[model samples]
Structures are given as C-alpha cells and as structure tokens.
Target chain A: MNEGETRKPIIVLVRPQLGENIGKAARAMLNFGLTEMRLVEPRDGWPNPSAGPAASGADIVLNRAQVYASTADAVADCAHVYATTVRKRGVTKPVVTPAEASSEIAAAQGRSAILFGPERSGLETEDVALARAILTVPINPEFGSLNLAQAVILCAYECSKHEGLVQPTQEDLLPPAPQEELDGLIAHLESMLEPKGYFRPEARAEATRRTLRGVLTKPAWNHLEVRTLRGVLSSLQREPRL
Target chain B: MNEGETRKPIIVLVRPQLGENIGKAARAMLNFGLTEMRLVEPRDGWPNPSAGPAASGADIVLNRAQVYASTADAVADCAHVYATTVRKRGVTKPVVTPAEASSEIAAAQGRSAILFGPERSGLETEDVALARAILTVPINPEFGSLNLAQAVILCAYECSKHEGLVQPTQEDLLPPAPQEELDGLIAHLESMLEPKGYFRPEARAEATRRTLRGVLTKPAWNHLEVRTLRGVLSSLQREPRL
Candidate 1:
C-alpha cells in the first residue's frame, strides 16, 4: 500500500453474510483506491472462493483484509467512524451525507473507519452505536435498498475526489484537428455533396453548406478521424480502395 | 408510471449490442425512477429473454422499451440531447457532468434525451454528432471502463435529485430524541459503566463522560431507538432475554 492508502479510511463490514457481497464491496473500495478492508465475522469465513470471481480484479483488498471478532475491535484504533444506514436507527449522532463525511474524513487526523451493515437489514443499533457519526444518504424511502456495493461505491467515489485520483476526462487531451484539416474535411464533404444534390438549389447552396458545416464541425474530430472520413469519401468515389 | 415520470428524460441507447447490458441499464434507470428507454439498432433484436433476469425487477423499463432505426429518429422530438462519451470525439459541443446536465434537463422547455453508446465502443462520430451537448463523468485515466449500468446510474441519480423523488431518509422521519431522553440515556450508560470503573481515574472521568455523551448524541436517534436501548439496558440489568 502507498502512503495515501495507509492514511485512508478502513472499510469495516459488520457481519456481512454473502461472500459475493464482500467481494463486490472490495471491488468498489479498490476502484476508488481504498484497499484496507476489515471483515467482522464474515458468514462464509475468509478466503471464500466465491469472492475472487465476483471481485473481478480487486484482489488486493481481499488478500489484505483483517478479520476482527467485533465491530468495536475493528475500529478500535480509528479516531472517527461513520455508520451508514437506511433508517433513523434511533442514534442521535450528527447525520451526514457521504459527500459531507468524505470531506471531513479527508481533513481528519488519525485513522477513520466507515461501517457497512449486512445486505438484508443493514447495520443494527449496536453496530451503529460505535460510529462517531451517522453517514446516511437521502434515498427512496419505499425502495431504500442500496446493494452493499452501491453504497460502498458512493462513499468511495466521494472520498476519491479528495485523493486527487487521476481523471481521464480532465487530462490535456489531443486538441481538435488543425484548422486546415477541418477546412479540408469540410471541402471534401461539400464536393461529395455538390453532385449528389445534397446542397439543393444553387441559390441556397451557400446557406446549406453553412448548416452542414455547423453539423460536421460540431464534433471536435481529431486529425485521424478527419483522415478516416476523407478516406471513406475516397472509397465511395469511382475506383478508390481502402 | 407516476406523473413526474412523464417529464423525465428519455434514455437512448445507440447501437447497443448486448442484451444483458441493456437489461442492466434498464435496472439502473428504474432505480432512479426513470423508465422510458429507446434502443437504436440493437444487434440481438428486441424482447430478448436474456434481459429479464439481469434486469432483476425493472420490468416496466423493459415493457416500455422502444426500438428505433437511428439515433436521430430516436431523439427527433427531444429539444435537448446530451450524449455521454469519455473522449473529446472531435465534438465541440458544450460539456457537462451528470449533475450539471441533469439540472439543465430538468428546467428545459421541451423533452430531453440522454444518449449512451455501446458497451464495447461508445458512440460513433455520426451517433455523437446528433447531440446538442456532451455528458460525461470524470473517471480514472488508466482504466476508463465504466460498465453500462454504472454510467446510467450516475446520470440517473443526478436526475432523480432534480425530480424530487421520494427520499426515505427525508420523509416520515421520527424526530430526534428529546433532550431529556438523551440525557437520561447518557446517565443510564454512565450508571452502568460507573461501577465497572469504565470512566477510569477520577481526573479523566469528566472528559470521558463528555466524549461518551458526544458519541451517544451524534446519531440523532428517534424515540423508538431510545426506547429500544432503554429496554436493552433494562434487560441487561436483569436476566438474559430476547
């Protein structure tokens, strides 16, 4: 684990019944870079074969999991704990959404633990009693059922924001094709359309081409795509080959 | 379908090839109260039995699923069309996250459609060209593999927030326990822990109790949970009982 991983909150599953659910929870945690998993009395025991396939590729979480006899023991050393639940659960602690808790956890000193209850009923009162704060999201009351993995992913996703995890969409991508290439592509399309009557009346040819340009230029096609489209037009011409 | 469901954005799956993926997307949409689904040129044909089990219980989405010959035909009536994709795709349309786009779709004057591409490869240039804007999520650079359901859920969850969908945690919630009950509960635990030397040295006892009170009061437990805990305490004081 890296320094960030060491400082990240540990996920504690209290009496989780299904090995598949545990595996999915593991997958969700690792997706956001949280790998420390503490299992409190997993029903099928540790190293359940059913988990590996379901986890897809989140093996590190399952391998590094520490089993604790109880929820309190699992989070004994953590300075803060957030218990997730669907109901009010009669706990009088501060109610926080996952986003709110994630920010606080990022800024908090020492270790933190987030508790998830079982798949069927969720965290019991005793389990919730151990948390420093209740982390419950506003969800459909009639169908307040968020599968274990969904809940974990939501929390992990929020937590990931503060970790500065890499974002593909945020990268300095290759810029749109050079102006000349775009212009060439437009000219090529116009030439092809001119004989096909796509431009229609000679009086409206300019305006029609402008609208077509607006449609074609809207997509920030890269150089390669422009080349590919030019190639496609060439193939459609007389005897041209790919 | 509910009244608000009529105004909800239509989900358009363009050139989707897999049945299971379509099913899962349907499930995600329904989870967030979205049911309208339009498929453009599904390779496996419509009404694939394979979709039923994977959809879990989102039959309404399946039942109402519409098939279209092209993306344009699918979204022809939509005033706003947001296409989801990771790459820039040479599309110069304005980009927005699911949350930002959901808000706009909610307030827009006419019908809105959010298009998702296939599982193997996202929308083609022609497919994306039909959109008025782009809707994509910020994801990991190295592994931008978000399955169909996960992507659908992110956008649907955001839209649900704007739809004012019923929230279990927000409604019919029992009021927080009265201050007197909270105090009594604190005292009850203190009384129980006192003789066992739970507070430890007299010098730190006050601080310990203060911390305990903080933990107990943070959950915002309702009267029901307070009573249950008090019953638990009463039971602990006597013989063991269920």
Candidate 2:
C-alpha cells in the first residue's frame, strides 16, 4: 500500500441502502484526504449511476472501492476496528470520540477500519459487536439525527487535522513592518491631523495620538502594505492629478 | 437576547446564490449547536422551496434565519466579525483557522459573527474589508474546492466543540459509585468466585485475586450499574436450567 492508503483509515459502509448516500459519504471522505472505501453489501450494488452525481468529482474513492458480503469480511484484514454508532450495545467495549479514534488510528500499526452503518437505521447490534471500540459524538438531545454525509464529515474532519494537509489558499503573509516604518506612518497621520484641528485642545493632543497609534497598530501591517498606506496618506495630503 | 441566542456566534451568508447551499449551511450550523443565521441579499430571494429538502430537517435554522441588505447590516451589532475567505486581497489582517476563530469567538465579549461569501466568487475585497480577522483552513493545494456547506461545517464543527450540547446517544454515565458501594461490589465478586476454586494454588491465588480486583474497578461504574452487575453474577452462580 502507498503512504496515502496506509495512513488513511478504511471507511467501511455496512449495508448502505442508497447510492446517493454512499456517494455523499465518499465526498465527505475525500474532503479530508481519506480515499479507500469498503462497501459491505451495498443495496444498490457497486457502479451505480446514482452515486456519481452525488459524489460530485470524488471519483478516486468510488473507483477504488472494494465490495464484501459481510461486515466481518470487510474488516477481516484490519487490526483495529471502530464501529461508528451512537447507542451503546449490551457488550462492553471502550468508547471514543472521532478525534480520539483518529489519533489512535494515526499511531496504530497495520490497517484500521471505521465502520459506518446503513443510512436510515444506523448499525445493528451485531455489527457493533465485532469492533474493538465504539466511536460516538455528543449531539443535540432534541434532534439527534445526523445524515450519513454529516457523520462521515465529522469523523473525516478529525482525521484530516492530524495529517499534514497543505492549506492552498493560505496567504504567505510578510512579517510585521519595522518599528521605524510604523513610527513614520503614525507621525505622518499625526501631521495631517494637526492642521485639520483634529487634535484640538492641547491638553487632549497626547491622549488623541495614543488612541490613533493603538488603532493603526491593531493589524500587524507588512512592510509593503505600510508603504502602500503611506502613499495613500501622502496622496491625500498633496494635490490630486487626473 | 436569550442565553442561547447571545452566546452563539451569528452565521452571515453574503450574497448566497442558491437556496440549497444556504439550507445546507444552516444544517451544518445547527449540527454544531449554532443557531441565528443571517443572510445578506440571498439570490433567488428567501423562502426558496429548493432549500427545505436539501436542509434534511434542520427547520429551526431555516425558520429563524435573518436577512440583511448588505454584509455591514448583517454584522452591525457584532463586536467580533470574522470573514471566511482564502484569497489575499492586498489587505493587512490577522488570519486564523476555524479552530482559532471559534476559540476567539467563544472568548469574545458582546455578539460575534462569521461571514461566508458567495458560491462562485467567494467574498469580495470590500466584503472582507469589514471583518476584524480572516478565517481560513488548510485545504488540498491541487484541488482547493470547498462547497458552501462543507465550508460551513468546518467552522461550525470547531465552534460546537465549546458548547455543551447534549449527546443523546451518550451513555447516561453516572458518577463512579460511592466508595462504600464499590467496596461491597469487590467483596461480593470475591465471595462468589471463592467457591468455584477459581483462585487455585495459595501462592498465585492472591496475585490472581488482585488482578481480578483491578479489572472490576477499572470502569467507573455507578451505584446502579454495580448492583446490576452483582445481580448478574449472583444469577450466573445459582442457575442451571431456564
């Protein structure tokens, strides 16, 4: 198995009824970098046309999905298995949150499988009995309903946090402008305000300048940004050219 | 405002095009215990029929969603407003992840708001200018596409972690039974196992019994649960036929 495959926990769908829901689950998985999908007797069967539209463009998960006849077979090769269910069964087992489970999965050797039950009824007692641990979240008491996609997203998101995923849109921020540049900017603003009588009443001039400095320093302005802002202030002080 | 309304952060949707995405975003918010959704000039108007089915049954969010003519109006009362955007608009501002933003929102005084932009274009530079900070996430560099609902879930999930929402599925774990009751449980189990010659060999018996005590005491079983376990063990020792 490749690094991506080994690192990611297998999302095992046990007796999923709807192809659309499976697709949505796949979409949720891919959003967090989880790609391997295992289907245990999907009601609509694999390669369903309905799943594609719901999956959007997460074709990698769907194309690589493996089908099995039973939940046991799906997770047989895995050393760690976590059954995703809210209710507690008669059997005694360690309970964990998705965050805790993902952390364990990250550290554990061999393969790990996270089992998600059918959409409408969730996991049966028999399905949960096979797992080493039960994974659950604290949800609203009045409305405890969570769709398949939402459930998958919650677990996948926790797993994603531990991985070194790159933040594509994150801005490469420049360091804060030097103290001299900031002082210059503050002095220029004070100079413009002086003539406008904005600092009026000599007694309050010191207090007013302090307040102005506080506001300007709130944002850690980069050197380039400070320069641009100074240019704007200079333009405001001078004559405007068409 | 009620405690619920005041403590929770406001979700502002700026220029949302489709009703389904709005509904989906609302669903994500409610899942994480957030209410109070503010819409800034939703395209195709409010009360769109397409939103209901898509929301899956998060009626409270849809019912109480407030609409504003502009982003300014939506966040007018908010003391801390975070703009959810990824692009660098040549502006200086503090950038924070959803987890960081939610933590700050949780600690902030007065009301706070999280602004999400449109589907195709995301937040405009002018729209982002009004925010106190920029909220963003580390996404896939090659494919940095996040749907409206997905983005909402990312932020909402982080915020929800702070709220003490009831997990209906969570076991009603009573506090560890009082010390007296726990001692009785250990004594009773030891008495029951004594007769069956379960603790064989005098030398190893004490060690084995200690191990048994350790195992029984691990789960912080409540008083009622202890009593139930005692009853189960008693019945197991006494019965042969149904």
Candidate 3:
C-alpha cells in the first residue's frame, strides 16, 4: 500500500441501496483525501458507469473499490472498525461520537475502517455486532438523519484533521522578519528618524530603538516581508531622511 | 487593566465611513475578547447612543473608544499595528490573513491592534503606512465586499482562537512536558527498548530516538502516562531482560 493508503481511513459502504449514493460517498471521501473503499452487496451495479460522473474527480475510489459478499468479509483484516448508526441497538461495544471516534482512530494509526449501512435500513444487528465501536453523529434529535455522503464527508474531515492533512493554517505560518534583517531595518529607520524631532539623541535614542525593535518583532516575519522593509529603507535614503 | 483586558486584542476602526458599519464592528469585536476600541476619522458619531444597541454586549468597546484624526495618532502608542484592507495596494508590506495576524498579535504578549478601513473608500496610503503590517481577509473576488461586522467577527474569531480563549473543535490540547522531563523520558524509553533489539547497538540512535520521541510527544500520552510507562518497564525489568 502507498503512504496515502496507510495514512487515510478506509470507507466501507455496507449494503448501499443506490449507485448514486455510492458515487456521492466516493466524492465526499475524496474531498478529504479518503480513497480506500469497500462495498458490501451494493443493490445497484458495483461499477455502474453513471456512478462515475457523480463521483467527480474521486474516480480513484470508484475504480479501486473492493466488492464483498458480507460486512464481515469487508472488514475482516481491519485493526479497528466503527459502525455508523443513529439509533441505539443496545450493542455491547463502546459507543462514541464522531469526534471521539476520530481521536481514537487517529491514535490507532493503522488499518482502520468506518462502516456505513444502507439508506433505508442501516446495518443489521449482526453487522453492527462485528464493529469494535459504534459511532453516532450529534444532530437535531427531532430530525437527525444525515445523507450517506454527508455523513461520509464529516467522518472523512475528522480523520483528515487527525492526520494533519489540512493546509498550513494562517496562524501556524508566521511572517516575522529574521533577527539580522530586522536589525538592519531598525538601524536604517533609526538613522532616518534621528534627524527629525522624532528621537532625542541624548536619552531617547536607545529607548526609541527598543520601541522600534519591539514593534518589528511583535509578529513573526516571513522571507518576503524582511526584503520589503529593506527596500522601503533603501528608498527612504533617496528621499528625505526625516 | 484586568487580566482579560491585557489578553484581548485592540480593535482599531481606521477611517471607517459609516455609522451602521461601526455598530457592526462593535458587535463583531464583542463576539471575541477584543474590547479595546480606537476610532480614527469615523464618518458618523462613534460614541453615538444609537451604536449601543447594535454593539450588543460590546458596549464597553464603544464606551471607552478613543477618537483620533489620523490612523498614525490612533496607533502611536501601540507596539504592533496591522492595517486591514481589501485591495492589494502597490506597497509591499507583510500581509497576513486574519488568523495569522491574530496569532502573531496574541504571541506578542502585549497590546496589538487590528485596523479596519472605511466601507466606502477604505484606508488611505498614509494610513497603511502607519501600520507595521497589513491584515487581509481572503474572500471570493467576484463578491469581495464583506459587511463591516462580519469582517470584525472574522478577525475576532481568529484572535480568540489564537489567544487560547476559544476551545479547539478538532485538536486535543496535549499539555507539553517540561524540557528536562521530556528529555528524561526519551532516555528511559530508549534504554528500555534498546535491549529488545528495537535499536541496533552499533547504529546511530538519533533517528530511532526521534521517531520514538515523536510518537510519545503526540497528544496520546501525558507526562504522567509516560512516567507510569517507565514504572511498568522498571517492574518488567525484574523479569527476563527481554
């Protein structure tokens, strides 16, 4: 298996009633980089041509899907398995929310599977009994059922987040100027402002320098940012210093 | 100032051109911990009683807001100021998304300001010059104009998340071990596992140590858990070396 396969969660659709739902599930899985797919006794054609378009660019999942005669056969080798259900069946397995399930699944870091049952009737008692855990998404109790694909998408998002598959967030990526560049910019700025009444050379120059450095280093600077300030300082030399 | 006051961000309405926009800005600022407000050339009454209702629980921001004639005067005392604008001005200052800007502000461990431009004309060139950096919100270019309050809310949300005030929805707050303790655990784990052929005696142990450290450093285990594991190993050592 490739790195992506090992890192991602395997999505198993057990006894799905429609090809479109399967197709949409594939699309949702792909949105969050979950490509592994296992299908158990799909009511419609397993490789329906119509399912391809609905899958969008998630063709890889549809193309490489595994067909199974039973849910047991689908997840026989999975190290961890979670059954998605809305109603409680009084199963002995540990019940978990999607958030908790994702946390546990993230820690597993091995062959893990999430099983989604058919649209009309979810997994059979025997099918759910096979799971290590039962997972239920929190929704409005009055009308809580989510579409198969939407459920798949939410689960996938949670799993991807566990693996840190999301892009580098704006917060994580800082743009503070480096020490060397900042020192240069500060010196240049100080020299230019010294001639103006902005800094009193006797007592306030050091104080002003500290204040300037504090401002410059307040936020982390990125590569282009340091260079931009250097350019601005160089330009200021050609203009009025004060 | 209270501890909360010291921790929150400063919301600066720079050259804001509307009363309703200012009201909405106050509402957004209140959603997060940002209560400090500075208004620079507001088009309408800033301390206007009409702004009270719109501010919701953010009445303090409006009540204590300082009015100024120029953005420079408004932010003169602030250690770090970020000018917010929608369009890309020719000047090359470090531009950050609201999220990045917030984290930067939060980490400064001092007062940091987020500047917003007027709804009609936005900030002027000189106003942008007054700031150390620029904060930009990524929106759909076709319909880029955001409501003033919505923009403030976005900035506030980012700021709150960075300040450790808002709980993370996806991540577990794994308490970090002190440097000395973490180093000791790393050594203990290495010693315990080395005898089991986990690391070859002759090979460089740095890579193996790093991999093990990475796993242990994950949110899965706390410092106490690591200590317990060490006790388990010491007790197990009483048996056969393996």
lDDT (0 to 1) per candidate: 0.74, 0.76, 0.66
DockQ of 1: 0.03
Please give, for residues A3-30, the per-residue lDDT of candidate 3 as tens digits. 6567566899999888888888887777
Which number leads on lDDT?
Answer: 2
Q: Candidate 2 residues A157-227, lDDT tens each?
A: 88887888864343555677898998998888666566556665789878767766755575467676677
* Ordering by TM-score: 2, 1, 3
* Top candidate by DockQ: 2
Off by over 4 Å in 3: A1-9, A31-33, A76-79, A86-89, A97-111, A120-126, A138-146, A157-180, A200-207, A220-224, A237-242, B1-242
Q: Model 1, which residues run further than 4 Å from truth?
A: A1-8, A142-145, A165-242, B1-3, B168-242
Q: Best by TM-score, which number? A: 2
In the predicted model 3, the residue pairs found to clash are: A175-A220, A175-A221, A175-A222, A176-A220, A176-A221, A177-A221
TM-score for predicted model 2 compared with the true structure: 0.77
**Candidate 3, after superposition: displacement of residue A188 in Å?**
1.9
Q: Write the per-residue lDDT of candidate 2 for residues B1-242, one digit (tens) a residue.
A: 68545757889999999999988887887777777899999998988787877777888889889888988678766656788876555544667888888777665545778889999999986677666678877665444557888888878878877676432332443444543465577677666555545555668776565444434433335555667555444543442331
TM-score per candidate: 0.67, 0.77, 0.46
Candidate 3 per-residue lDDT, tens place, B174-209, comes to: 233333344565577556555555544447455444
Ranking by DockQ: 2, 1, 3
